[model samples]
Target chain A: MPLGLNFTQIFLHLFNFLLLFAILYFLLYKPVKNFMVHRQEVYRKEAEETSQNLEKSEKARAEYEEKLAQADREIAGLKAKSGEEAQAHYDRQVKAAKDEAEKILRDAREEAERQKAAIVQEAQKDISDLVTDAAEKLALHQSSQENFEKFLDTVEAGRAEAKN
Target chain B: MSKKQQRKMTVIFVVIGVLLLAGIFLTAGASAQEEDIVTVIRDAVIHDTNKIALFGLEVNPGLISGLAVTGILTVFALIVRIFVIPKFTLVPGRFQMILETMVGYFSGLAEDSSPHKNRLLSAYIFAAGLYIFTGTMLELFGIQVVTTAGHSVALPAPLSDINGAIMMGCTSYLFIVVGGILNNGLGGVKGALKEFSLPISMSFRLFGALVSGAIVTELVYYYTALSYVVPVLVGVLFTCLHALIQAYVLTMLVALFYGEVSEPSEKKLRKLAAKAQKTEVRTAEAA
Candidate 1:
């Protein structure tokens, strides 16, 4: 054969290759490929699981956050409500105390005014009596010093009685 | 091992190198007349000198070399299968990483090329890559064998022989056709047959690349003036590069064509049927 191109040798080479291919397929390629594919499947499953877990955690976190936010909003609302109630209560108490204090001052002032009016009336009566005695004394004893002195004594007696 | 020790070793290596060059030149002065360059080149290209008998038939030593490589690869596969593969963990060690990288690359290529159905494609490419790569690397070892006539023959790469290249190319084409048939049926066969030149091109490509490397290396070795360090570089460059490049090329071509032929025929068939129905309706409307 030209260039030593033997058909037998070519077939032999082909057989040799086919044989090698078969051996390597089972021994080398299959095992490695199967392992790699298996590993890939495993890694893919792991990644999927990781992503699923992440999604679950994210959902849970959002739920918790929502709950926490709702609780915070409730706490804020309760705090405002309690604060308004306390203010209302304090205002009512202050108004009641102010009314009580104003009433006490008004009663005391009114009682003082009544007492002054009574004193004024009694003094006016005593003064009127003294004036009448002085007029009579002046008329009976025309310019007598003893009558004037008697009028003075009577005025001093009235003042002393009023002080007592 | 230390910096200083390394420097000393470097100096010693340099001195040895210079001495060797001087020794070679001194000794090669009155060279024994060797075989003609043309004859050597022709023999290297033809695998004529590498003759051996196998099973009562005189055979080219490329067969022996191919068998030896196949045997070595098989034993390695067995060892790795038994010991290394069993110990493979999720987190890869260096050995596991190497195995994974090689296998992973081929698997990915197959999947990308033949997405519809890639198991057979994957196996074929992986096997083909391993074989071609090992076959190419066999030349570097310069393995020798004794024939029945007591002739010692240095085994070159199998693809350096025409028969091996033809087998590889034809086999790849055969796989491509098979993939087509398996996936696309008659339509797949049509697709594969369209690229009829693929086998011839692939065969010549592999053969030319490998034989060229072998021829060039042989040529360099035949000349005393250029053989010293040039041959090693040339041999390594050609052999290793050709091994890697050719292996990738052949596998890629096979996977690409196979994928093309083996594409989901259902999708194309449906589209064609729809187009035909539309044309029929249009013709009826015109009538």
Candidate 2:
């Protein structure tokens, strides 16, 4: 009694404490802690899910960006290729037109040369025939009017042959 | 002034003057009628007189207060478990915030002290801290019960009793020792045994600290003219301070000791983990 030390009271206190402990463990501590744990788990899962979604979107965006870049590069290559092809086609068409024009001019010049040669040969032949006829009329000593008339006829015939 | 108004004014003045005079006389009379300093100190230290007999053993008011603390805590827990717990949201409300702060503090303490295994330890400290805090705060209510001997007794903090303090100390020591033995075998027991004075020191610490605060509060109430207001402050603050300090000290000591003893044996830890994994696999297969 000096220090209020009693075995029975000590046991009662222990019992009372134990009872409170049990009650709190079951009713208060467990459930509240469980709720807190559950909430933490939920938030963690949500955070993880959000992170995964972000990662997926990031990957998709990167892939799309890569595809876009590739497409741009391909389009640039196609444009250059097409432009070169068009240039080549235009050069070919110009060359072909020039060759065709040179061919037409050369053909016209060749035909004119041939015609000049033919006219020259005919004039020479006519001149030769006229000279021969003049000599023969002088050697025969005929009248001057008759010789001149034959010369005129032979010159007219040669002129007509040259015209033809 | 009218005669009626004049009469009312005179009456009000007389009443105010009489109340002032009465207040002075009451304070003076209260200071004059003082009890013995030694007896007050003795009563503060030990409340063994007029003990109640339960199971043929005389029990102190501290024990009764202990019972009351337990009952009150049980009811509060039951209420929180039923009503408040169900309504708890991820984003906490006011009451939830308060509860979380209290519980989280103890849990964090447990985690700091016993890093290896803290779930059970946290629960333990939470219970112990709650009991101590609630028991010490019980005196604030000034709950009184009349005994068969025709004397009214005011219940006080449970640990004010030497027996109750001894109980707390021994319980905590036993808990730590048991934890050590269960976790680390004979080595933990040896470690626990080395701290043989822990129970006695813890018991006296709780008892002395609480008794000293009570004594000073009683001394202030007895010796001072301003006992009415001053003692209220001293009693409340001292009691409250002691409640928080003692609860923290006991739970902290237990956590430290339990943690030291209950650290898993290093050499056997791998084997235990492997065994646990095997069992888990077996269970999964069985399921």
TM-score of each: 0.83, 0.75
Q: Provide chain B TM-scores across all predictions.
A: 0.86, 0.81
Candidate 1 at residue B191, lDDT? Answer: 95
> Which runs in model 1 stand beyond 4 Å of their true positions?
A114-164, B1-14, B29-35, B224-227, B266-287
Worst 10 residues of 1 chain B by lDDT: B27-36
Tens-digit lDDT string for candidate 1 (B1-287): 89999999999999988987986787675565355678667876776654788988777777887898789999999999999998988889999999999999988998998888889998899888988889889888878788655755567788888889899999999999999998877999999999999999999898898888878877776667665777668878778888999889999999899889999777877987899999999999999
For each candidate, the alpha-carbon lDDT, in order, equals 0.85, 0.81
Residue B250 of model 2, lDDT score: 92
lDDT of 1 at B230: 77
Candidate 2 structure quality by residue, lDDT tens digits, A71-163: 999999999999999999999999999999889888878877777767667666757665566657564776588777777787777767666
How does residue B79 of candidate 1 score in lDDT? 99
Alpha-carbon error at A71 in model 1, in Å?
1.5
